[model samples]
Target: MAQWTVVRAQHPAELVAASHLFDGPVSHDGAADALARPGHVVLLARTPDGRDVGFVSGVEMRHPDKDPEMFLYELGVDEAWRRQGVASALLDALRDLARGLGCQGMWTGTEADNAAALATYRRAGAQVDRGSVFVVWDELDGEDVPAR
Candidate 1:
């Protein structure tokens, strides 16, 4: 049995090794934003010998006309560690953190086609809410994306 260690990383540099597991636009800017917020939780999970294996991050959410909830910002487990319950363990930690903060429930989004991710969340007891997302990008002069 492989034991795991979960640690909160306040520094982005510590997270570089595990960045590829994350799905969306994660950079220094995103890491800075997450760590700067008091309501955000950034975590790294490692094997017993200190080899990083997975990560799970989330932000506390609020709405003017609705109850508070936890928004799971990211969850990533390396291909080498997929079947050992790393992702599920990370989610359990996130849920515990959310419960500690008095959140009513938690939510997360993923690409519709990611069966592994969907199964992971489903196994962790997360409910899927169907919704639509609309994104408007900053236009570039015929290039794919404007240089930032």
Candidate 2:
């Protein structure tokens, strides 16, 4: 069985680890600063033996032209724990947190080819919003960078 920890990210190491698993661990300083911002939720998941197996982060967003929402900034489970409902549990917890923070809904984007993630979100009862697309134009190359 998996156990969940709902502790504020108060240490560099903890936030660093969460960023590594949850969002590629770009920079410890930047990750810490970002997590300190308002309306951020970071949850870490561990196993009975105390291994940190997963992490999820939510960021509140209020886009000018869109409704208020909470974005799944990052959600990741270790390779050994995949497909075991860790991700789903984390998301459900995030939704509850969002609701408490006055968010109407939560949103996230995964690569179109990532069927596993799509399936997990579907299992969590989240339907695709379906109207947003990621478009990138490379000024240096003067070409459109297509989704990889």
Candidate 3:
């Protein structure tokens, strides 16, 4: 079984633990600061031994013309934990949090060919926006950037 945890930006230790599940190294303080910001949220899934197995991040967005909404930013599960209900649980936690904060609805986007992700989102009650195209803007080239 998996355990769910909601990490707030004010909780630095939890934020660091959640960061370990990401693909790259994350600064604990930076993560905490971001999490502390209005509308930011992170949900983590841990094993019985307390190892982080998955995590989901989201943001709350409010516009003058529309009610507040949640943007499910990302979701990831450890290879060994895939296909289980960890992802769904994490999403449910986020949804509950969003609702508590007065969000009208939640939304997330996934690649059309990513069957598992598509299925997971659908199971979580997100309607597929088939007509939408995901886009990204790359403002800088790696060659011109200084080493981190």
- Clash pairs, candidate 3, are none
Clashes of 1: 0
lDDT of candidate 3 over 16-63, digit per residue (tens):
766657777677767868777887887777666667778888999999
Query: Model 1: per-residue lDDT, tens digit, 1-148?
Result: 5488888887866666557767754688777776888888877888777677899889998888877789898787888888998888889888988898889999887888888888899999976666756365677566877468
> In candidate 2, what are the lDDT values of residues 1-148, reduced to their tens digit?
3465434455566766555475455477876777678877777776665567777888988878877789997788888878777888788888887887788988888888888888888999989756779775548573665667
Ranking by lDDT: 1, 3, 2
- The ten-residue window of minimal lDDT in model 2 covers 1-10
At residue 101, what lDDT does model 3 achieve?
92
lDDT score of residue 50 within candidate 1: 67
> Model-by-model lDDT, in order?
0.81, 0.75, 0.80
The deviation in Å at residue 38 for candidate 3 is: 1.0
TM-score for candidate 1, please give it: 0.78
Query: For candidate 1, what is the lDDT?
Result: 0.81
Clashes of each: 0, 0, 0
